[model samples]
Target: MPYVEVLAPQVPNQRKAALAKSVTDGLMTAFGVTADTVTLYFLPISPDDYAHAGEFEPQGAGQRILLKVHAFRRTEAERRAAAIALTRGVCSAYGVPGDDVAVYFLDRDRSEVAHDSKLASD
Candidate 1:
């Protein structure tokens, strides 16, 4: 299972849906998880609240999306492949520069999560 969180500027509902789907599809393909096992949260941050380097501009940050994926442990090779797939999916779905799509993975032990009210360690 994977829990995905996206931080970006405001987006239309349709675009948000596409963003979620794009990420979900990428993770599913790369990690072999089902749709039900993938959870996504899109957080809209004001441009004033976002800054890059020594500047702050709404559109500057708006043009990019930060993706964080939390999931069970995986080999380094798998992690790299998943990052590439995630970046490609975001770029393809949103017409953004590949660099604009940032991906970070937070790997956890199975004991750290649960599913269907059952602990993963169970």
Candidate 2:
């Protein structure tokens, strides 16, 4: 399976969505699949969204993380497992510590995806 992430500082929601679409397109092109079949997850957070070192400090200097996951399963448990694995992979890939990265798995069902929409639902 292939997934992607955009780890950056706090940005506008439009930028966040655009990044999601771009990464989803990249994943589709990389995996020889259609964008409709891919689910791009954007985990946008501010410096206050998490707690660091037992204090409400910035994580990795307030680095925002976007996690994209591809999971095929018949049950919720398997889906979550795949998601967790994907999060771990993204964390490792960006050299962002697992404890520092905030993971958000955006699940886009094929039904909710539309031609002119990045995602009908978050």
**Largest lDDT belongs to which candidate?**
1
Q: Tell me the lDDT of model 2 at 32.
A: 51
**Which residue pairs in candidate 1 collide?**
none
- Mind sharing the TM-score for model 2? 0.41
Whole-model Cα lDDT of every candidate shown, in order: 0.80, 0.51
User: Per-residue lDDT of 28-75 in model 2, one digit per residue for the tens?
Assistant: 443455766665544555555655457676554644465545432225
Q: TM-scores of the models, in the given order?
A: 0.84, 0.41
Q: Global lDDT for candidate 2?
A: 0.51
The TM-score leader among the candidates is 1
Clash-forming residue pairs, model 2: none
lDDT of 1 by residue, 1-122 (tens): 79988887776888778877877877777888888888888887766776777677665654568888999987888788889887877776667888788888988898888878888989
Looking at candidate 1, the ten consecutive residues that score lowest on lDDT are: 55-64
lDDT of 2 at 103: 43
- Which regions in candidate 2 have their CA more than 4 angstroms from the true location? 1-10, 41-43, 52-55, 64-68, 72-122
